[model samples]
Target: MASSNQQVPYGYEPPQSNVRGTLIYYDDFNDITDAALEQAAIVAEQMRFAKLVLYPLHEQTVRRISNEQVAPFYKREQRLQEWKLDSGRKSILVEGWDGKRKKYTPIEAAIRTCMDHYSSPYFLLMTPEMANRFASFATFEEWITKISLVLTRQPDHLHPRMETFRSRWRVAGEQRDKNGKQSEL
Candidate 1:
């Protein structure tokens, strides 16, 4: 029994208690293998049946192996120079080197090998039924409310790595703030 004047949270519809229609979801294409595409398809199907839409997003296919793989090609002494030039600064670099040589695990090596040879495909899947259901919403705000609700309920639809990366980034930011406060004192 909330009042009309009360503000509603983003992606949440005030009048409607349940979410409906096809909701758009975005997922990154890290490695476009059969397994990866199959997973995307399965998630898409699950979402579609649940009355949600998924739109996987990929910026571009990484054409080369990550920097860690290529680091061995360059001389150890020249690593920093190469990094400053172009070798290690590429977007394909996932986990960067820690300034010390470290052994890569078998799984890591396998993933790098695959990335070196395969081209990642961008994924975007949506059903044709979306337009009809979307029209029922009165305003853009209402549509956003529905979309937000869908995303909130379906965490599995998101890219797992991205969430971990975001959490780490948040922790790092908090640590930086704490350090700055200590330095000022």
Candidate 2:
């Protein structure tokens, strides 16, 4: 470690991070395709995130949250692992908290855990359907201010809360121009 007394070269400065924050892909991963994975990776890279964390919900959690049935968690997680390896993305990480708990994990708990572990300014990458579902939850208002949302695409319909907090979210492939107008990337 460099001491406080250590002097830097006259024209040199310490390295600073160009990448910022974490992009968390929060989903069940039951119907995610390889193309979707690529889109997520592309988003993370484009946004210059420090990491891309795939937080797959457990089957019970999915059932509780969305009232949808899904395949076993292991199968889904293994598939994600395989994809990560095949894609050769060093910054991609598969979070296993829900898998290890083996129970219905609440969205609030999941988000809190992620916030505790990852860097600040978190952005949740989710499909439009999932984003709408999340907005319908009771804790949506509380969480919305804590982190931003990046939907996979523009939603055909929006939850009332989502509509109310429109500024807190953006479409994944859309970026703001110099004048603050959104344009497709």
Candidate 3:
């Protein structure tokens, strides 16, 4: 939907035709359509029950999504480049490279050094009726012990269109997936 001529101070007022004879229902932050919002809502509900509703936001999340949700043997293959980090906290950085991939070039490991040490079990108290559970055991050995490897992989045989869904949605699309979908509601 194009912005209406009825411009307001902050931004353009949404055109009535785009809104379909309004009774203002709800709008997301950037003001995408209701159908988009509904699809998003459904995705969010699915994520709350699980995590599939949301797209991966971080580099590790990208790797995790690949391994658990899409690729079989994918470790977080993309590494982070060198930066002093926004916070002064010095983390044990681990560098790995993929000659074929582009993105975070060298991985900056979080403060938790899996190579040399493990985390102590830490807990979070979110609510009275419901709570969050996280396990922290020192060393990759313990962490790997508690985690189960997912059996899914990026099948080499999906239709070409299927390739888009496996990528990170946070950035501009350069892959087949980004140029593939129009995202209509």
Candidate 4:
């Protein structure tokens, strides 16, 4: 039997999207510079991600993960806002879900929330140290395969798991070899 196709109205075709995936910048934002934020945005644009989410970790979350002291969450968020305004980038988003909770938010929860709210193919952007700390988490192996890592820069040292999963990550602005050494692009 032949199937008949129904004609659709002009200009009413299904919506199409050129971009694919979300680039989530998850960090404490204590010492993040405007330059670093710009780099992340640039990376997102270059990769053609639909959105660049700046997911700032609350102070408690920072302490639990790395015992590092961070400025108040409000202050950090304000800084992010200022950068967003100055950069005038509409695709940038500063997520405050963790701040609203006012306590430590596990990596698992943070990633899950992002997954639920954002588009597929999530890529986590973080500093070298933060990436290492995330690798130490029990859920690292489970989540690593689900999402890719984008380190601000290659780390001087590597966590064992990071080493084992080296193929799962890359430097933001440059390419590197298997040993984490800079390689020609």
Candidate 5:
């Protein structure tokens, strides 16, 4: 039989996506593996070929655009508009990373910051290279990869510090996936 440890997941979809086309979400960077973008690309491709159903989250709701001086007692009703789906379509968030600067930002924010309306259909970047080229990583995989690389590069005398690098996620890909189902924190 093939060694069980030899197998690994080539790609994985993130756990959440309450938005379509523009939603880039993350549980922060979990040390840069670029898993987020990979998932988004796959979903976006599926959406392109099919008449994917639109969710309420994607619909336009009334907005008070400006409240600079107009609101004395008036407040916006930002309710729990939970994103619902009919089980056919899946959504993912995409983002960008700046390798040289060693930072990442939401693609929407980056576009708005440059005052450019141009943006990509995808939003959640999973790989560092992809994130840098794209716009942002909804989750930071770099930190994840960073910590991993650090542990791997540690000096011989620093084994204790290496234990901190050891994470329960280090199990073979399949087991790790199952274990990851629990709360991240």
Candidate 6:
């Protein structure tokens, strides 16, 4: 008789079949080896994927614009009106200021207002390289403070996907801390 510790290749059904001709496992399903589990985890990590979806901040009704439709307008440095899918109509673009062609002025004012309202420091991913460099920080809060300081001086460097990147990092750091505590316990 084979010992319980003997390695069993996956899909190695015993030389028996059910009445329906389906191979049935005789061993306990929960007896997966640690190596097998680790291999599965590695494969999953290799295939892992993520996507960022952006929604309007306060608008209840909004439209989805395809990349192709928006690309030309963006390339030409022209303002495009947001489309409303529910009503099948285009919404008027609201200009924050009159006759000003500055790019960062509006964004800076908005960021300052938000910072004043929150009265707390926050983080921005800024760039892919910056996000990757954040791993060297001692803690997530420290990283946030550093990024907030940079934003206070130069808010124009803020990345378009900063919120998504921040969320991913925050969740990952929380999970790491939880695992550490569990291991200690």
**lDDT of predicted model 3:** 0.24
lDDT of 6 by residue, 1-185 (tens): 87577678998977852211111011111223444323322322232312111111111110121112212212111221121122222211222221132222222343344344332333221223333333333453433433332111113343444443443333111222444331110
Clashes of 3: 8
Q: Quantify all predictions' global Cα lDDT against the true fold.
A: 0.28, 0.92, 0.24, 0.91, 0.27, 0.26
Query: Candidate 1 versus the native: TM-score?
Result: 0.21
**Best by TM-score, which number?**
2
lDDT of 2 by residue, 1-185 (tens): 87578677898978998899999999999999999999999999999999999999999999987899999999999999999999999999999999999999988888899999999889999888889889988889999999999999889999999989988898998997777567998
Off by over 4 Å in 3: 1-79, 95-116, 122-185
In terms of lDDT, the poorest run of 10 residues in model 3 is: 19-28
Candidate 2 collision pairs: none
lDDT of 1 by residue, 1-185 (tens): 87578677888855742322332222222222444333433443443322222222212211121222222312332432333344222222222231232332222232233334333321113221222122233442333322222221223233333232222211101122444331110
- What TM-score, to 2 decimals, does candidate 4 have? 0.86
What candidate 5 gets wrong by more than 4 Å, as runs, is 1-30, 49-111, 114-185
Ranking by lDDT: 2, 4, 1, 5, 6, 3
Model 3 Cα lDDT, one tens digit per residue, 151-182: 11123243232233223221111123346442
Best-fitting candidate, scored by lDDT: 2
- Model 3: which residue pairs collide? 72-153, 79-106, 79-107, 80-106, 80-107, 118-138, 118-139, 164-177
Q: Indicate whether candidate 3 or candidate 6 has the larger lDDT.
A: 6
Worst window of 10 by summed lDDT in candidate 2: 176-185
Identify the runs in model 1 with alpha carbons over 4 angstroms from their true place.
1-20, 23-25, 50-144, 148-185
Q: Which ten residues in a row have the lowest lDDT in candidate 4?
A: 176-185
In order of listing, the candidates' clash counts read 2, 0, 8, 0, 28, 0
- Residue 151 Cα positional deviation in candidate 3, in Å, after optimal superposition: 20
Off by over 4 Å in 4: 1-17, 175-185
| lDDT of model 6, residue 51 | 12
| Model 4: pairs clashing at backbone N, Cα or C within 3 Å | none
